[model samples]
Target: MQDNYQALKEAGAEVYSVSVDTHFVHKAWHDNSERISKLEYTMISDSNKELARELDILDESGKALRATFVLDPENVIQTVEINADGIGRKADVNINKIKAGKYIASHPGEACPAKWEEEGDDVLTPGLDLVGKL
Candidate 1:
């Protein structure tokens, strides 16, 4: 995750990590895990799960599911990924999605769909007028 965070940083994007763990546990985890300790992004501790609730990351079991949100510069949620506990979590994919978004943003008349790739055809401005074209 930190690796991806660093990549995003290199790309001139802001990144942050929010955890449901308490500040003490979050601190302990950071202190114990050498990998996470060197992170440049801010690690947010939400022991009360305020952010988890707001983001709807918590499942019916009352446990926060592994989730990811990609927000645009305006803080608008552009992508959301949530999964059951079995799936665990990975930040690389989300980082790639962010990269795709950045590319689309820079190119203007473009947008990415699920599982987008660099070479995929971006939506042209005129194509947008054809929305619902089957």
Candidate 2:
């Protein structure tokens, strides 16, 4: 996601990465790894397992699982995705999800359809019977 940081920010999203590694490990990777070195977002150390425990992402050895949490402005979790080891994440897909979330937030009573990618994309609205209650 480092490569798409600017795009994510432009989409009105703030990204924070939490890891089970120590602060020192985070710093070392940031200093030595080219990709990590280019990261511009915050990286939090969860070595004490505080966040991992709360999130219930701990593994057998106490390692945090790979997870993505999309939260609303009120800090309420809107969506969550957890992947097994070796699986990957896609920034563009997440960008679309964020866009759809923003659109839904503003356009009450309407919901984005499957494969919705942007603000002008097609959305699903309630029937006359449901009206604003949708």
Candidate 3:
């Protein structure tokens, strides 16, 4: 998560992380890790699990499920991913989608697809020509 966070920071995006853990534990994790010290974003305290439950990203054990949400600059949710309990969350994927959303929204006449890249097509034009390609 920290590694992918650095990538997002490099891409001119602000990254915020939330955890179901207690504030003390979160602080301990931050204190124990040198990499986390360099992070510029907020690591939110969701000990009550309000955010996870609200997002429907909470597990039966009351822990935050591995999930991601991409929000446009205006804070509209653009894309979301909720992973299975056994699967790990790939922060890179979320960062990429956030980047894509930023790029598409700014450029207009554009949309992204599964695992999109920078050179990928800007989709959803008035004509259906780019639909299949995207």
Clashes of each: 0, 0, 0
| lDDT per residue as tens, model 2, 55-110 | 89999888899999888888988889999879998876778778888999999989
**Model 2 misplaced stretches (Cα beyond 4 Å):** 126-134
Per-residue alpha-carbon lDDT of candidate 1 for residues 43-114, written as tens digits (9 for 90 to 100):
888778888999888778667887778888899998898888799777777766777888887887666665
**Model 1 reaches what TM-score against the true structure?**
0.75
Model 2: per-residue Cα lDDT at residue 51:
92
Best by lDDT: 2
- Assess the local accuracy of residue 27 in candidate 3 as a C-alpha lDDT between 0 and 100: 82
- State how far residue 112 of model 3 sits from its true place (Å): 2.8
lDDT of 2: 0.87
Q: Write the per-residue lDDT of candidate 3 for residues 1-134, one digit (tens) a residue.
A: 67776788776667777888887987887899887776667888899888889898887877788777777767788888787869877677766776777777776776666656674554444457756664
**Which of 1 and 2 is ahead in TM-score?**
2
Candidate 3 error regions (>4 Å): 33-40, 119-134
